[model samples]
Target: MGTKSAFNWVTLWASLLFVVILGFSRLSYGMFLPGIQRVLGGSYGQLGILGTVNFIGYLVGTLCLSPLISRFTDRKQVINRMTCLLLGLTLIGSALSDDFTQLGLWRFIIGLLSAIATVLVLSIAMDAVRPAERGVASGLIWLGGSAGILVTGLFAPFTIDPLHLQGWRYAWVTMGVFGVIAAIGFDFATRKRGVVTIPSQTESKLRDRESENVYRLLLNPKRFLFLITSYFFFGAGYIVYFTFLIPYLVSKGTPSLYTGLIWSGIGFAGLFNGWIGGKAIDRWPSGYTLALGLTLGTIGVFGITTNNLLFTVLGASLIGLVSFITPPLMTTALLRRDIPDHLYAVCLSIATAFFASGQIIGPIIGGIVVERHGLQFGVASSAIFMAIAALLAGLYGLQQRKLEVRDLPISS
Candidate 1:
């Protein structure tokens, strides 16, 4: 294979490993949510808490991974895959959860393990690729998430029974088993002969310090506030759709089978959206691209309101397509805003934390709205957040233009 083809295959394999990491660890919870909730007798608010705990696990992992991995950088590769291994096992163990409390704990473990895998995969895998290819690597890894959703969407309908819950447990066990096998396969394929000392804790510390300093230098209250707040709302808006849409559909008396189809459509749309979004980041002005994405996402969120099946499917497609698109664009915008290479890692990590925090709260608020207003209305409420994110992006773009115009030299 040529260089391009070789890298494509390498990235493809990386993405597939990510699929196992997310599928077994995280997505399975959502896919199995409806049945498991009924089986375990979880209330809507409690289930919302369950989702919140999952992101909290992710948030904790995101915060700790840098420091933890910095302590063992040469073994970072080992650390990453081991996380996958443990993640698979934990997910398998979750099938045994006997109640909502147990299920919540299990999902939290799943979230933690997946977060470690995610931080490792995104950081390590990008390091392995060319600088120009980093965006593509991020897209592929995210596409791996879409694949996870697609697999769950295609599989869950067949595995579920409106009257039976055993299928839910069985599905969890099956994902765990396959995840273990995939994890082992990856380990064998990437097995190496010798250790590289440069990936050491010392390097990690130096890098961390660089990121910290760069972030501090780049700090500007007005501009960074818009970027960070936009990210925060994105985290808030998207999770509502992801966590509750299926339950909403099912509660409305939509068949379990149709719920799977809707989710699968989301996964399918996301595949193309990731690619298109990455390219848009490369070509367009950062704020404008983000503005467009959030606006499209706002339209997608509103699409959830109507009861028509056709409209539901169309809405699901739009929501999926844009769900993961805007975040990457935000990343592009950050990097393009004159950040240096060393600072990119830390800045991105901080921004991602904002997103994760939004995720932590999104489900709670969404759950409250759903509990009080009904599922459709709960989903509709998310649009308000997306609209705000779009507005923030617009303002940021305008701020940049004014700064640019003011920088022009005076005429003699």
Candidate 2:
């Protein structure tokens, strides 16, 4: 097979693993939220803060470990070991939590581990694939994310009954246990020989040098400035949609069981969106594809704000579709830009940390908005954030065009 074709297969497998692991780790939060609230009996304000705590942990983990992996040229083994370790910790945390305070602490750690595992997989895929394939590669990776959401939603309703047992705890433990088992199985399966791809010695050494250089280059204060700014807003805007869409739907009079199903639809659509988004990125400019998705999100959020049930459901699906399109497009854009491969993990990790920071702040902001104005306005507010992101993204595309012109030697 050609190099691009081979990489496509590799990205697909890696992404599948990531989506399964990430879906279980991240989306399960919603499944357990209600059960936990019953025991804690806090206002929406308090629960929102607790959600922020989990995201804080996620942000920290992504920021700390994304760069840490740069120190190790071959981190596949480390990734394996850490994945299992984190999963085991998750199970232990779930089984032992005595109250909300303790549960929040454990949840935080779980969020960190979840970020590490997902980012690691993405980093490896980016490192291994050709640039031309990145969009598709990213799309494949996000398919696993969609699957993760499906798993959590499917299991949460059947697995948890707050009044009967610690259904919330049970749900968490099950996901953790399964993750551990999957990790062990993956470790054993890959133990035989040289499965990981490494560059030639000269290229490898060059890559290592470039990794350190990227830190200095990023300090240029102008090169990636627009992309960086756009990323932060993207984080804040995208997360509000991800974290609250289902809950908002439920409040609007969608039945609880249907809420779970809607969550499932989000995941299901994301599975296709990742693949479609990635392919679109490959066929066209990353900016156009990304802007398209963000625009869809803006329109969807605006529709939700109107509070019509049919519009709400349609809007939710559009948001989900648009949301899934983002990761692959944005991540591929980052990878293809001026950044180097060796430091890709760290840079993306740091970006994710900022993304996490947005997550950390988004819910608290949402809570305050909900309290002061109302949930509809709170939900509608995501459109403002997404609109800003889309606008900035458009500017970045123009900036890139200008750079292309500048590099043309003033000839044309």
Give one clash count per candidate, in the order shown: 0, 4
lDDT of each: 0.69, 0.64
Q: Candidates' TM-scores?
A: 0.87, 0.86
> lDDT score, residue 233, model 1?
86
Model 2 lDDT per residue over 339-406, tens place? 55555666677666656776777778887887788767777877887787777667666765766522
Over 4 Å off, model 2: 1-13, 88-92, 159-165, 185-209, 219-222, 336-338, 405-412
Give the runs in model 1 whose Cα sits over 4 Å from its true position.
Answer: 1-6, 185-208, 214-219, 222-225, 325-343, 396-412
lDDT of 1 by residue, 1-412 (tens): 1123214544566677667665446655666778877677767778888999998988887777656654554676687678888887877788888987787788787777777776565654555555555555566766776777788887666555566667777777777877777666655544431112244466567776665554444345434556767778887887887878887787878877778888888888878776776656655545667778888888887777777778878877886787554464445444533445434444555666677788898999999998899888998888888888788777766765766522432110
- Candidate 1 lDDT (Cα, 0 to 1): 0.69
RMSD of each: 4.4, 3.8
* Residue pairs whose backbone atoms clash in candidate 2: 19-144, 19-145, 23-148, 66-346
Clash count in backbone of candidate 2:
4
Top of the candidates by TM-score = 1
Measured with C-alpha atoms, the lDDT of residue 24 in candidate 1 is 45
